[model samples]
Structures are given as structure tokens and as C-alpha cells.
Target: MNEALVRATIPQDLVKVLGVEPRTDSQAEAFTRSFLKNGIQPNSRTDLNSMLSHKAVVLGYARPKKDKSKTKSKRAKGLNARQKRAMKIFHIKPEHQRYELFLPLHELWRQYIIDLCNGLKPSCSPQFVQQKLLKADFHGAILTVIRSKCPSHVGTTGILVQEFKHIFKIITKEDRLKVIPKRNSVFAVEVNGFVSHIYGSRFEQRASERSAKKFKTRGTIDL
Candidate 1:
């Protein structure tokens, strides 16, 4: 069946519903002439729907119109350049790094750890204490480097000011900030007479990551 015949066979009601104007004999003849001139065949059977769709595309009605109000712009993930630069510029001032200023913070941390360890009861299982301490936040806790590869870091006690992935920044009793690497270092904290030792080498993770991570127990750990 020819395209012209197919168009002619379409019902009048469908042509009205599709909002299409029926092509007259003169228009069809002109279209056939144009197709032949362009080296195309007009013998293919094209349905009314296909014809209307083609007409819509030619008139630019088929392309979807974007509504700015309905389309939401996606927020970029993580810190931007400005935030990174600002972080570099803003740091704890030396004058404000007094250990006395963080005494209240240390008290709060002591209370928090005591509560986290279920009051640090004598009957509490070692496994439970270990699990809680593994995920515990050490910010504001008084950490004393009991043992370390660096002899100078040994016995250095201070309030933990900040914790990084591989470093611990602490404000010493002398009101100085000491950057202690977590590699091959051991820190101890006493809470209500219950002393807990933190092996830094095994805890080389951010607080957020340590909270979610599962640690496997080995017979021996290096350092």
C-alpha cells in the first residue's frame, strides 16, 4: 500500500483527533515530486500517527521544552575550592591553645567515656570495653604517650585537641601544641582509675571510619 493511499484510508475522526490536516491531491503530488528530486521513495506505507509525529518534529513541537523551575540543579559533592582555602587560613591560635582552657572539655570527655564503657564496671567484659573504646572519640581526652619510637614523645601528656587520620594534635600542660604521629606510638588514658591503652599503629584511621570498621583480632600486633 502506498503512503498516499494509507493517508486517504485514515478515518476522518482520527484525523480530527490527531489535529492533522488531510493532504489534498495537489499537495500529495508536490510531495511526491520533491521526494523523487531528493532520490527518496514515496511508496512506503506511513500511518496517520507516524505522519503527525513527523509533522510535529518538523514544527519543533516534538522536542521537549525544559522548565527551569521544575529542573533542580545538583549540588556538588565534598568541599569546594573556597572551603579548602578557608580551612587552611583558619587555625587554632597559639595564645588560645592553653591546656587550662580545655580542662572543662576534658571533664566532659571523661564523663562521656565513663558512660560509653557502662560506668567502667569491674565486671564489664574486656571485649565490650575494647569494642567501645575502638569507636570512641578521643577529642578532649587527656592522652599520655606511654611508649613511642621517638623517645621525646614518650611520657608527653596533654589534652587531645584534634585527631586526624594519622596524627594526634594535643595541647600540652605548657600550653603548646604537639603533633604526634600515630605510627608506632602508644597512648594511655585513665578514667575513674580504669586505665586504657591505645595502640596508635592499629588505630591509623579517622574517627568516623574507626566507628564503622570491624577489627579482626590477631595473636600479635606489630608495635
Candidate 2:
């Protein structure tokens, strides 16, 4: 299909993929534009009949509650490939002049960690972390935050936030990076004074456990 036809048809396809019961024509159009830019796929039809004979869009006749505006649309930025992939399971809604989308269960855990850090005083400095990879106190504090903050630590013991190592290094030493969340959860944040979902994770699970067990048994750092 040509880009225009594909683009034109994309609104219907995205709603099918997004599973939102197809609310409005504008919502579908916005979704299609974002989905195509992000590289999401559409479902299959067996033949021309399925595509043509079944002329009904799942919620075709329903009109949107609000008028669609280019100005409102432009105010909200677009989604990239990675963000789109992350949002595959999320639910999207129109509100407050933007699309707010989320993965409910996943965010519950992520939010807990963020809330904890935001509550804590910034006592653990980066020089303290980098020079002494063995900052017993701060390391202990981090592990405590992880355990209390994340139950999934019982599994991989906490690696999801570890992906942001580049982000963390700045917070630890010379640079302070800040994260401003987008309407979409997966949107990237810029840094300055805020810590991102990214932090340099030399956070090793096995080593921490081994060291703790050894200290308990022999009362010494594991070497």
C-alpha cells in the first residue's frame, strides 16, 4: 500500500492493535500517526472481502466527545520506536490536552522506588560511590531501598533501573541530571538536577549477597 493509503488506513489498524474499543476518529488518527512513526504492526485480513465487505470499523459511527484540534495535537510530541514498543501493553486516554498512557501494574513498582528516593535526603554522594566501590553504608542504603521498594528483586534482584547507568554517573560525580517525565511513561527525560530512571549500575546481586554471608560467617570483607 502507498504511504497515504497506509497512513489513511492506519487509524483503524492501531485501535485494533491498541485494544481501546476505538473511541474517536481523531484519536485513531493521532494513534495511527504515532504508531506508523514507531513501527507497530497491524492484524491480518484473509481476503478483499474482509477488508472491503466488512466495511464496519469496530466503532466507526461514534463521534468523539471533543473537537479535534491541530493546535492541541501539536502541543503533544510524538513517540519513537522504543517508546512505542514499551507501550504495547499500555492503555491510552485523552485528557488535559494530551494523551496519557500507562502500563498500570508495571508503574506501581517503578513509582514506589521513585517516591522513596524523592523522600530521602541526598546523602550518598557520587565520589563516595565511585572511589570506594565498597561504600558499605550507602551501598547498604541502596540495597535497602531496592528491597523495600521492589518485590521483583526476589527474582532478578533489581536490574530494570540498572539500564540507566549512564544517567547515574552524572548524579554520582560532577554532573547532576534531571528527568522530566512525558505524558507517556516511556518517554526519555533530560538531566540536570533530577535523577533519571538511568543510573550507572555497578549494582551486582551475587557479589552483595556473597559479601554479606561471608561477613556474617567470618566478619571480614570478602576480598
Candidate 3:
């Protein structure tokens, strides 16, 4: 074959073998010059074969890098302003606030207390019972306001409905939903004939918050 034909054919084969198609003539010429610089002559059949026998070196453009700072990660935002406003606006109707309506809830609460106190056996320590009561879920409990700073709040009995950060919403036997402030009030509950008193003054926390909190026993509280 002619030397010019051999040179042209070698570069074409190099393009195929290397899997790189040079976009411009300058790039193609540069690739050909680099190949020729490797000292492999393409004029003779043996030299051409030797040149083709060598391992092919590929060329490619690098992939574009991604920017991590531009990427947005989702985060949880609990109870938005709209939801908080809606909660305050919507409340249980007076007609729906009946004592019989929450009897099932009270029963469930009684069973929950029983299981929590491990059947409230006589062998159970007073300290253990007290601890359990402090962390107890009182939504279904029969609560009676035995003592309160407000005279009108005293002797109020109801089934607890919603427990907030500083208040207990209870549905009374008169089909009335009463919002009792936890501050300066004392409530009583009976579990399996064992009566327990709760000092509402110190119990001013959400039920969820109370569950994970540790309380220190006080000798005497003037309430």
C-alpha cells in the first residue's frame, strides 16, 4: 500500500480502536501526531500490524459535577401556624359533650392504669405507683377537682377529654365540657379502690412531656 494511504488508514483505525471521534481537524491531527510520536511506523505491513497490536488509549470529556449546596433536603415542620389556628378555632360542641359518650374511653384508661401498675397489687410499692401515675395518660380518667384556688372549680367531676400544656378539658356528667386550669388545683382518681391525689400545681405539662420527665418528691406543698 502507499505510505499516504497507510497513514490515513492508521489514524481512522486509531479513531475506531480508541473509541474517540475528534470533533475538529486540529484535534484529529493532534491525536495522529501523538500516535506517531510513540515510534510505531505505519509504512510497512509488519510495522502497521505492530502499531495496531498495541493497547488502545481512550479519550473522553469528564462528566459535569453536581453542586451539593444547591440540593434542598426535606425537613419536618410539625404543627404549622394555620394548623395551630385551626385547632384553636375548632372544638367539641356542647351537644356532643356527654358523659356516656366517653364511658368507653374511661374503661380503656382504667385498663391502661391497671396494666401500667401491674394489676395494682398490694405488694406494689407506693413509690412505684406514684411514679407510674406521674407519667400516666389521663385522657380517659375520671378526675374530680377536690381542691382548687377557685371556689367554683371545687367538687367538679368529669371525664378528661383533651390534656393541653396547662389545662385539662373534661366532659362533665351534665354534658358540659369544662376547661380546668392545672395551676393551684388538686385532683383525685381511684384505681381498684386505691385513691390517688394529683397536685395540679406541679402537674402543668403536656402528657407526652410528662412521660419522659423525672419528678422529685416534695415533703409538703401548700396548695
> What is the TM-score of each predicted model, taking all chains together?
0.67, 0.16, 0.67
Per-candidate Cα RMSD to the true structure, in Å, reads: 9.2, 27.7, 9.3
Off by over 4 Å in 3: 1-71, 74-76, 87-90, 217-223
Worst 10 residues of 2 by lDDT: 165-174
| Superior candidate under TM-score, 1 versus 2 | 1
Residue-level lDDT of model 1, residues 1-223, one tens digit each, is 7878856556887988888887788997687656544543457555544554464423235668899876786775888758977887436887898999999999999899889998989999667777788888999999999999999999999999889899999999999999999999999988788777899988899899988987776454332
Q: For residues 1-223, write the lDDT of model 2, one tens digit per residue.
A: 6877754433666777877573477886676556544543356333433533564435236676775564375566789858976886222222411211122322553444335444323674533322232322121111111221234222121112211212211111112222212111211121123332212133233334423542222333221
Candidate 1, RMSD to the unseen true structure:
9.2
| Backbone clashes in model 1, listed as residue pairs | none
